[model samples]
Target: MGLQTQLRRAIAVYRFVALGYPVLLGALAFDALQRPVAAAALVALLIGWTAAVSYRYTRNGYEPKVVYTDLAVTAAAVALSAWALAVSDRAWPISLGPWLAGIVLVWGAAWGRRSGAVAGGVIAVFGMVFRGGINENTVNEAALLVLTGFTMGHLVRLGVEAEERTRRATERDAAARERERLARDIHDSVLQVLALVQRRGNEIGGEAAELGRLAGRQEEALRALISSEAYRHPLDGRRDLRELIGRHAGESVTVAAPATPVRLPTATAQEVAAAVASAVDNVREHCPDGTRVWLLVEDDGEAVTVSVRDDGPGIAPGRLAAAAAEGRLGVAQSIEGRVRELGGTVQVVSGPGQGTEIEMRVPRPREGDADGDAHRGR
Candidate 1:
């Protein structure tokens, strides 16, 4: 059941327990004969308050302000019960039995351990003040309230964490399956055609041999792309994009990032890292020998950015558009497509002899966001 449903059920159980308080007062009404009307009025208030709070709890989602107000009212009712009984000289105790303690538990279960502890302590002290002194019964009641609140709060937090883990695992599994399907398609169709073109071009000779070499290189790039573990489940629960992107640094490639971690969702970091890797690959393919590449990662709180730049002779204007028209889809699909899937933007900045830079910016995921859907679709 959902957390709210569990809360509602627990509240219902408390209401049933609260029912006995009125019954107890009715059975012992004769004991309060000195101030019978006052005792009866207190009893009516307790029952009515319980009913009204129960109705409100059933009709709404958790409202902290309202819940806290209920707690205050519950404490007040307990206080009044003690005052009325004391004035009437009743023999029986003025304690609300387990009813008041349940209110503390609900507070804890709804808000968390801290709230529970405060509510328990507050009501326990009030109960002591009304009951004359702190004795074993009151002590036990207070301890139970604190314990129940702390324990239930932890359980609720754990349940929420477990639900989140399950959702992420499901999305991770779906993404893995999709990647596998794409790998199979690439291997069966594109890889086979590339292999045929390479073989035919080699047999025909002349400029065909040069075309075969380019086709062979592309086939190898495609193979490496499919073999990447970027789609696999992340190593840690939270991902640091800096580490993933920094791993690309080599003899000619330099990585620069902040000393502090740039934290992101695992799947998002992985995809961004993969896109960065593709940018690096483009640099490697087009840049002249001895050319150096630099990767810069930054997190400005609102968004995370990774820029891949190479000190190589850059292409003239319309080169990328021309490549796209000629059916070379690396920049379009690998870099731009991957970033777009994450609800991010990728900008390619380059000009003749001015080097190339692919800068990708992905905004930080917001709280309560369903980021798993994006990963699954990828």
Candidate 2:
């Protein structure tokens, strides 16, 4: 059941339990009552109100008018207690007693902490005015009433906010996952067909070459549109690391990823992916023709690892440092820069004729934590 419904039911239950306290109080003071018949009538009225409130709550009576009437009746009953019983200066109201707190709870649950506190104060003030004076006992009772209203209402509000957050997060995850599925479908069908058309059109010259150029532009636009990370909450949604890496697979490149999605936040996934792309680009620029590349994605509970390997002439020992010293910073600025910004590490394993393998290791971002907080451990 929803939080509000459960709170209403709890109020109903409290009404039934609290009703007995006043009944016993009324019976004990019946002989001493100045107007015994009226006191008995008020007691019966309380019983009927409790039963009706319980039944209405069960039937989903969430109307504000019920709470209003309840507040009015409770206040009225407290006022009448002084007239019905001769013991007017007694510590508690003869007609209401603990039963009055139930109406305070209803106000708190239906409205919020402030409204509940107001309801409690209103009841206590009405009781004090009717009973002629506010003593230590009456003040204590007022404090208790206000405390009950504020605490219950505050707790209910907290639960409602928590539920809303959970619901929104669930919807966002679902949307991102569905979009990932659609992207794969488009890549497998529409993207491949467009690529084929562009290649064939270019092979046949003249007007066909111009058509091929147009086709290529359209294909790029469609691909970018489908893969755009322009979300309203851009950094919030999760994207599959697999989908980003899988797009690089071709005749000379092989991609391997977990059977299930290796999901990460949109920004983190995109950054990691851009880092991978940079590595592959570096390979293509320097390596010989027909050099093979492999991309591997691993999700090992605590962290995500993406590895790019190439069977090409390897970087000579200290060559990257020499290149960096000469201001040729392709590896440092693009690959290492992107990964380090995401609190990840990059290791380049290469020597002459050993080929090159670059590994990027990043701890999974902790849910509901800031980037700095993720570094602080979950």
Candidate 3:
């Protein structure tokens, strides 16, 4: 549908047409050398067929049906060549042209190496049968044709694969640019206003103070959401679990993690971090003032688990389901969504008048897993 795609189809059609020219020439030559009257008539017929097929293909814009018709034409040409070789005295040499032409057809069509190899084998068999013996020159010609066909076919296949990869890369780059643009626009306009409101409300007491606190919380969440660092660039240096948790700890918040490093995918780490932050925010919102929050990270080799617990009022029965129904979907979208996207799971244990505990478990990469490098490349 795109210009490049249309061009590629046109190129394929042209290659198909161009390949037939040599076969047509060889067919006419064979007829002239062996049957003069038939040679003239066959040449006329070839011209007419070629013109008709070309017109149909050009008009159809290289539809699959039109392409198949061209393939039928090639098959007919191959049949005609075989018939001529069977009847002619100089069948051995004359057959080589058609064999080479068949190889060209297979290669130009972008069939894989196996298809070309199969064509080579069939032609070689016919050559040996027609000549009644294998000679050095015949064997050499066969080998050359086979190699040429295989190489050309592979080259075409590689070109197609490379083109496809380029197209996907282009699309991905475009999408990334769009996301970055949206992030910038949100930060410039909405985030700036939120920040101003939060700061102003903090100065003015009463209802404005409550609004300011809410604005501040929202601003923090938005900042975390839009921060490129939170996305965890693969090329950036890795951080140990202890260091990562410590960075988020506060005077009222205690972090407990293993001393040793727990390697993880960048995405996995970021999601876990965001989930921890969300859990912390929820505890602050629902718990008694000045209640302590504890963060724990455990690395069990097979999986890494992170838990955020607060001795605060826990969720009531059916509260989560009710919240979801009411479109209060922050926890579901922010925490659960993040964990699920990383191929991990999240569990919440809570009850009315009790404490809340949020646990997230992410599977560890196996030894020598290719995904280790994939994370490093993120």
Prediction-by-prediction clash tally: 0, 0, 1
Off by over 4 Å in 1: 25-48, 83-92, 133-140, 193-218, 234-265, 280-312, 317-351, 357-378
Evaluate model 3: give its lDDT. Answer: 0.63
- Candidate 2 at 51: error in angstroms? 3.6
Instruction: State which candidate has the highest lDDT.
Output: 2
User: Is 1 or 2 the stronger prediction by TM-score?
Assistant: 1
State the lDDT of candidate 3 residue by residue for 1-378, as single tens digits. 543344445544554465465455565665545544444454455557656755554455446555455555554554554444343545343343532444343433334565555556555555555554588755875686577657655765666556655665675567567767878998998899999998899899888987888778677766665664433232232435454455567777999888778766544565677777777877767676677899999999988899988888789988988988999876798888888877789898989877888898878655534233211211
Against the hidden reference, what TM-scores do the models get? 0.68, 0.56, 0.65
Collision pairs in model 1: none
Of candidate 2, the 10-residue stretch with the lowest lDDT total is: 369-378
220: Cα error in model 3, Å: 3.4
lDDT of each: 0.76, 0.80, 0.63
Candidate 2 lDDT, 1-378, residue by residue in tens: 777777778778878788788677767866666677877787788788888877876686657787788889889888887776544445545646688798788877777788889899999998788875687767877998999889877897788777766776886688778777888888899888889889989999888876676677557755864776632234466788887777778788999999998888888988888898889878876887688999999999889999999999999989999999999888898889999998999999998898999999988888764332211110
Model 2 TM-score, 2 decimals: 0.56
C-alpha positional error of residue 358 in candidate 3 after TM-score superposition, expressed in Å: 3.5
C-alpha RMSD of candidate 3: 6.5
